[model samples]
Target chain A: MKRITIITGHYGSGKTEFSINYALDLMQQGKKTALVDLDIANVYFRSRERQAFLEEAGIEVHSNIYHSDISADLPAIAPSIRKVLENHTYHTVIDAGGNETGAMILNQFARHFLEEEHDMLYVVNANRPETRTLEGAMYHYHRICDESGLRISGLINNTHMLRETEAADVLKGYQLCHEISEKEGIPLIYSCCTEEILIKLKETDAMPVDFNPYRIRLYMRPSWLDR
Target chain B: MSEKQLMKGNEAFAEAAIRGGCRLYFGYPITPQNEIPEYMSRELDKVGGAFVQAESELAAVNMAYGGALTGKNVFLSSSSPGIALMQEGFSFMASAEIPMVILNVMRGGPGVGGIQPGQADYRQATRGGGNGDYHIPVYGPASIQETVNIIYDAVTLADRYRNPVIILADGMLGQMMEPIILPEARETVTEEEIRIQKPWALLGHQDKKERTVVKSLRLQPDDLENHNNKMHEKYIEMMEELPQYESYRLEDAEVVFVSFGSMSRIVREAMDHLAEQGIKAGMIRPISLWPFPNKAFDEISPKTKMVISAELSIGQMMDDVKCAVCGRFPVELLYRTGGMVPTPLEVVEKTKALLEVTK
Candidate 1:
């Protein structure tokens, strides 16, 4: 069965970037991968908008929109989803909209996995709305869980600054993940590290890392790179 | 086992947990059920187990999630409000088929009611207290011995089906101490055994084997329907496999008294009163409320005329009794909530009234 991975997070939590890069890496490794843009919250900067970038790299990119006029109604995309699950043999990466309002698309697709088709990852940035505090992140966790009928299997910490990202910020993100992993009962599966910086953040905690199949290539248990 | 012991319900639960071979307990202390965590803190070290008063109920339940995922005999304890906070994790445990035990030494609620014993949580416990379409097997023990036995069995049942099990007691059961026999300790699997047993549990997939993802996400309509159907099938199987009941002269009685947990003890005493009054009353106390003893009443309804359900809530389990009896027999409910424990005399009076109405 094709592995389905859902990437979701609070607003401005780098879910799109992570999803795009992860899908790119998976495809590069000869894994048949597809990226679905389910980001309904942010109108612009959606990974869906960069379909050409993915398709040109010999990958598949599907937008979450079914009808241009009725994009928000999740039921509209069910038939297309049914086709994909039935016909496609690709590593399906679902880039969910940020926050609770955007992740509502999950409910529409809920009927698809009667046999448990996918694993959900709740991407987090200690800096995002409703995720700044531990309590706030928990509330969002419950909200998505209650609404989507899906328990977050793992977490992705993309706590960083767009231009002024630092190693300290990355470590802070790991601390938050550590606290969440202890409390939520799910492991901190991985954190995204880009090629723009060196591995300056020490692995002070047990939460693992995902190198997004880029510059980092060592598949060590602590910081495993997909490539 | 000695005679009645002067112990609190929470302390009894803690002792019962130890007797049940519970090696890991994660909890955040709330009123009424705080003694459970306190006792665990004191006792876990002696048993070479681990206990943590988590940052919050959220963390405690999640830690329970990890422990359950690891397939260890684990438990998490809390009161009503705390259980409410852990509902999401509970649902996750249920769906993921994570086997673990939970003890809700219930206190009054509707949003932090009081630290008093209240059966008002009946709805939340019996129904889906957690989100989604799932049910957790619930066991209500009437006495401290029953608490020990049920906690032990909760662990067994949870692992047996790979689902979460809850022991729903009240403040009275948690705080009150009666004569109890601690069972002989059984061998439980270690963390290494856990890693060996469930290779699918997210223990950092170093095996380079096919990644076994344990998630409850069903995105397709047909697939979701199939999942629900499978869950229903398991529930049906549970109904056939796990229904338990205790009968007090039910074979020859005219009216059957239905109650559970602490309330059934009162009904037991009430049955004695009814016997002296020359009333043919028997009690049907359900030990497992979810896989409800539906068949028990089906077999008993033909022999009995009326069923009187005495509960702490208005009539949560009464509906189950009615459904179980196929709605052919008349079922009446008698209850007192908000930390009220009905006396034996009160139950006898209510049983008499129910008999009159059925007649």
Candidate 2:
């Protein structure tokens, strides 16, 4: 079973940062990694940069611009999708667009690939659109499942906003995602982690999956990091 | 391998669903297609599968939606009106990019028009029927064997593309019986294997690492435009790679006839009559409506003198043929409506008339 992890969330959610770090982490863990830019819907924290960087780090990348002024002229990327699924050997992580509309491109491209066996993970920032409340999150989930023809397998609570985010918000988002999980018939797979927040969230009940920063550390770590 | 047994087109679809790994069936009884759901109700239980006589076509499609959510190979059967009721759900299914098959045993349209066969819904099936710019891979099978084969292909294509696939057959195909050799079922990947492999699905977490979402809402114009561009890309990809059609005696022919579904059968008979009369003619049938072999018509336009499109509708496929020919050659339509099919004699007469006018 070749595993392809897709890291997605609403606009302004920290899905891109988490995606970059996660792909590098998997690579550090001795796995082949491929990161795809599925964010044709948003540009604030685009994934195309990660495409070149990931490739430089010996990871494959899929970045096709399907949304642009010359939109109708864009060649369909099914052949590329087929190639990636057929040839890949490592974990592939697609950084889908902000909303379901944007993410639908990936779903359309990989529709054949999303069978009963595939895993689709939704990144939830409690502050994001259509996900502020449990009911809102469930609405987004149902809509996404219906549009993409891909069943969502789990959720990743990544509630955050620049430096304004606190450990408490992550836990709150986790709980909200958990409530929505009952409606969607899936679970929150993991929660985003930060150094200060991880220590603060340690006492919290929501299980947080440690986002691997080792691969990024090998290339370029954040200015604040002391390795 | 016993000899191919004669079976109704609807029964062929039912049997094909079983052979194609469709383990779940959800449908409400409708005229012409009732036998399909009835057959499924009886056989699904014996095969350790799930079958539900949904409260209505609306419920049936949604239940199939539930079955599809479970990553099960699922199917739903309905007639024209019932299919109309399923449009809302189909739009959702199309937007979600779920891979499933829908068997539309088409009857007359607008309301509960008639129990008789009609291709009037050709426009509705090819065009997006619900709110949203969505498309389903539509296949019009002309025979019982094609009914089974198209169902088999529809499931595989839907699963392969992760989009809903429609098997568009009229009441003639659904109610009529013919001999067919059913194919053996192929081994498919299990849902658990899919769960393990495609980590983007909405399955509950096995290992908590990050949250994933599935959505299609793009609030901004640029964002939405980009999403639409992506869909166009998918359509182009299907056009170039998956255009499905069958052409007979097209080479070195002066007159070419275009038809689909049951009308194609009549076209074939007409072509045969033309052949016996020593009047050179050919025929082309489109099995897939979305990818619509427009390029095929374009390729042969220069060589052909006259092209006639015969359909069960006023002229649904004529739009496609006209678009393809681009007035490179003379294009004409031989159409019938109100659920009544034109016979081979009628089609032959139209073909002769077209040839005379153009030549």
Candidate 1 per-residue lDDT, tens place, B159-268, comes to 77778888889876775433344566666566677677666566666758677677777789898788878887887777788878777788778888888887887787
TM-score of chain A of 1: 0.80
Candidate 2 C-alpha lDDT tens digits along B1-359: 33344344676789889888899998887777876887798888877788888889899888887677766778888989999999988888776667789888887666878667789888888996888888887888777777788788777788777778887898877755454678787565576876764444566665888875545556798987877777777767777877778888888778888888887877777777888888888888888887788877755736778888888787887888888788887778898876666777877787787777765
Worst 10 residues of 1 chain B by lDDT: B1-10
lDDT of 1: 0.72
Candidate 1 ranges beyond 4 A from true positions? A1-227, B1-8, B301-303
lDDT of 1 at A54: 78
- The TM-scores, one per candidate, come to 0.58, 0.58
What CAPRI-style quality would you assign to candidate 1? Answer: incorrect
Candidate 2 Cα errors over 4 Å, as ranges: A1-227, B1-3, B197-202, B205-212, B216-226, B298-303
